[model samples]
Target: MNEKEFKKAIDHYRSLIDKEMANEKVIDGKFVGPKKLTKKDKIDLEDIIHPDRPFLSKDAPEDLDSLYVTTFRVGNLKKPEVLTKAGYGTDVIGGIEFGSNLVKTGLIESVDDIAPFLAKYKIGILDLFREEEVEDGKKLDIRVYECIDCAGMPNIGEPVCYFETGMLIGILSELTGKEVFAEELRCWTSGYSCCQFDVDIKETKKGLDG
Candidate 1:
């Protein structure tokens, strides 16, 4: 990730922690709701968050859409892991392009709203956060339990949910009309109970301006 993306992510994390603090919890050594503030700076929140944080080291990937695969085989893709973002861009943005065409043809609503609609065709639940769950100007977090790609695949020992991450960014950017970034923070294959992704959404005002 670049500097701008890094800053946006860090700022969102701080706000997430802030929300937790509001509920009266000692998180990262700070209290906000009813407890006293122990230190001026706890863990120096800014110092801990940065960009270019690589989590995947998979040697290869396979694109599932390339074939008329079965229901059990979705979200699969093949690509060199070195490119980092290539597989995701190809899959996610390509899906958006296809969805856009459908919308233009009056076959669907919009690219942004297509996720939940398409979830029926997918293997796992693509749970997106409701508007009330997120405050304005903050990043969006999504979860996918029993993800099609990672759940049944042989354990790869790391997060390989990049395609879903990219899909989320594409969906939101199509809806919000702003450049957004998505990162997979956890994956079922990575030993997490579910697949979790973080997205740096476009600020509502900027999206409105667009």
Candidate 2:
């Protein structure tokens, strides 16, 4: 994402506080009492707290490219395997939470609307190019263009969008209520223009108690 888009995202996040707390007002020094929260409000509140870093701060870099470079240095240059695994694992939870919240808040009707949601939130451009039935469930071939993590990166001979892959898996798993797995098949770091993911979701067997 560019500086303008990043700042816009931050602004959108800041705007939520007012929207969610429309009924609340400052009492003397602090906003008093826990106001009755709707499901949407709760979702918004959850989002504000769940992120790794607070978006409320005004102090930030003009561009996020440096941050991206630093992350690459730490994850790829330092301990590649360990950092990649850790990032994927952690971001999975974040994705699940975000997907659940989006649905609950009526932000998007369902998983079919995820591509627009990603673009609206300045995450990436997601395209599900292929899908077919498998014995267990289904497989999806997805592509991500202008990925926030590694869209224009140099060739590192390995995929570096572990977080993005894990997030997609988590989102699909939560939305479909199935076991999801994903493998990064292509990446800009691997001399690709866009990122590609091979995702598989399997259906679970149920007890025939009924």
Candidate 3:
């Protein structure tokens, strides 16, 4: 997409974030937290066709530049409630984790074996709607990643995919012409599990504006 078009898309998503935030209901007087995959939890992700790899955590370099957004969802395969309540389909075949495994393993493995594993895992998207009550000027850290769909590639690192983040603040900033704090953006990689964006969101903003 062109620069203008991409900005418009970002703006639209930002509006969604705002609307969701404003309409959010308090359950028992507590704001909700975004759904997320912890570093340890993400390590066990398995695919049908690819061999699993040990978890890798890389400290994001400070000098890198990129624009990122924070968003949230639960990402375990075992919980059906996590998927259904979040409005994601539990029956949908070939989700991000499935694709990641396919890309990592060079084989087009049977979908049946993978189905059971996926059923035990769930990616919670509802957590994104949960907000923590923070004093004005308080800061939070947000994680971001890119989602890639490897088309018949066996190598874990070779596939091209889409990127996503759980940072609602950044999305709102882009939509509302405001600035989001840099420290709020965190980066992660879910190899063969989902498409993750690794670049800095701050750098991306500079490029878009330029």
Candidate 4:
């Protein structure tokens, strides 16, 4: 997309996010938080695909600038719920494809390699506490220290690394050859020293019988 088009897209997204945040409230004196977007309010699938490409283009002068964690934290200050969903939406639309390519290209060859690869790329320092076979598939307890998304961020009362959670989902799904889902169980923004994810691997039909 061209500069004007990219700016329009970003503005449109912000409008939607603002609308969603508008419904936020306090219940029993506790913050209700940003409301979820309904079907009509969601960002279109096509728009979510590679939404970062515009920002990543070398030809884009804005690309010369780097966004700090504080910038994101400030954005999340009032719209954590919507922002989290936006991150997940990006993953479902294209982040998975992007992450799977890491394995497809031999960058990540095994489950044991995930941590080192993450560290190599400065994504985070990954720690695998344990993995166990569940009834249908597997469960992994994973932690990330110095998480790019929320490390050193002040307590935000909720987990705020939906993007990273989705990244792990994609990476693990490709690495294990199964459908994987990950949930952010803890985060620095939620008063944790590290980010923790509970990953669930689902057995496919082929794997079920194999």
Candidate 5:
């Protein structure tokens, strides 16, 4: 990934908060309690939280370059290896786009689905840090694969990736300084899938330097 491009995207998203506030748009704060909601509010929240949307970009990968990096957090190395072995040649349910080789894996339908999954599985955040000897840091690359179930299927207008739901939680944990637990993992028809979970950092490990 291009570091500059990634940073630009982060900055652009950060700017949206101020822009929305200036325009008097109602900004939904992070969901922190069980507040009663109206039917319209529930629907609006679902649309924003679980948008079955796919991003169409001419710059997206082509047929010959369909590989993408899939990231995940397996607290233990053994689990990662086990998952890799289990996922081999497995077909994942998702949508495929016409004339393009991009496959979208449906991982979750909405944030509301996270709690149930978390109730079933144990999730943890993983941090991999290292001391750099040089002023410029080195880049680490990981290979992403399409789920075996959908790898050879014809394009049906959905997005696919090899990423796992837990990895996404790890990313959020690192970003928000909280412990994220999974509730559900669902593959979406929307070119991509997302995981929903509640975060709690009450008694997590801290101050480890790699």
Candidate 6:
């Protein structure tokens, strides 16, 4: 499809998804931690597909980027209410872990140069940004028009994708050679049409020094 037509298609589909998402009751409380797991609990859990696997599944969509986003989102969000119950801390940790995996792929070298790489991950829809100066660091931003995490899912009232947030921080930290902290300030889950993440850097001057 032509670029104009393709954007239209995305807008139309997201319009419907936005409405459906409104029906979700946003949560205002913290995640209820899952009961501490036993070794057997971990062992007994069946090995389902990795969250990123379906992107390459035999029946996967030819549109690699979109397919990967949707599949990765759907696969991970399958039981978010149950899964996130591990607590918000888990989200950041998981984001870092997953981000580490992405780092291993070496697609994105630095936060300032993340656009093209993130586009590959999503669909050329991520906007990379750098905010004002900091006392001892800098702020990085990523604004997304179509976030897969909350695209089709019901809204839950707060930023529901710390995984992406922390992942960004971790990746940027490696790229910039600085300790980075990231947070989701807004979300589609809270009725926002887009998702924006802010990053705080520590112990480094602005710009991609790493």
Best by TM-score: 6
List, residue by residue over 103-133, the lDDT tens digit for candidate 5: 1132333433332232223121111112222
lDDT tens digits, residue span 100-172, model 3: 4443463324422232222222111111212243443223332211221121113222212222222232333
Give the alpha carbon lDDT tens digit for every residue of 36-98 in model 2.
Answer: 322221111122222222221124465454454345434433434446455555565666566
**Residue 179 lDDT in candidate 5:** 42
Which 10-residue window of candidate 5 scores lowest in summed lDDT?
A: 94-103
Each candidate: how many clashes? 8, 0, 45, 0, 27, 2
For candidate 5, report its TM-score. Answer: 0.25
TM value for model 3: 0.22
Model 1 scores a C-alpha lDDT of 0.46
For candidate 2, the 10 contiguous residues with the lowest summed lDDT are 41-50
User: Which candidate would rank higher by lDDT, 2 or 3?
Assistant: 2
Model 6: what TM-score? 0.59
Q: Which residue ranges in model 1 land beyond 4 Å of their true spot?
A: 1-112, 130-136, 204-210
The order of the candidates by TM-score, greatest first, is 6, 4, 2, 1, 5, 3
> How does residue 170 of candidate 4 score in lDDT?
73
Superposition error at 19 for model 3 (Å): 1.9
Every candidate's lDDT: 0.46, 0.57, 0.27, 0.58, 0.26, 0.53
Estimate, for each residue in 106-209, the C-alpha lDDT of model 6 and write its tens digit: 76655544554544445324545447677777766665555555533333445566677877777777776677888776555544545667778787543646
lDDT of 6 at 195: 61
Off by over 4 Å in 3: 28-210
Better of 3 and 5 by lDDT: 3
lDDT (10s digit) by residue, model 1, range 1-210: 233543444454445434533454333442223222333211122311221111111111443322222222322423444554445556666655654454555544564445445444443444554333345455666655445555433223345655566656655665656667677755533434456677776565443554
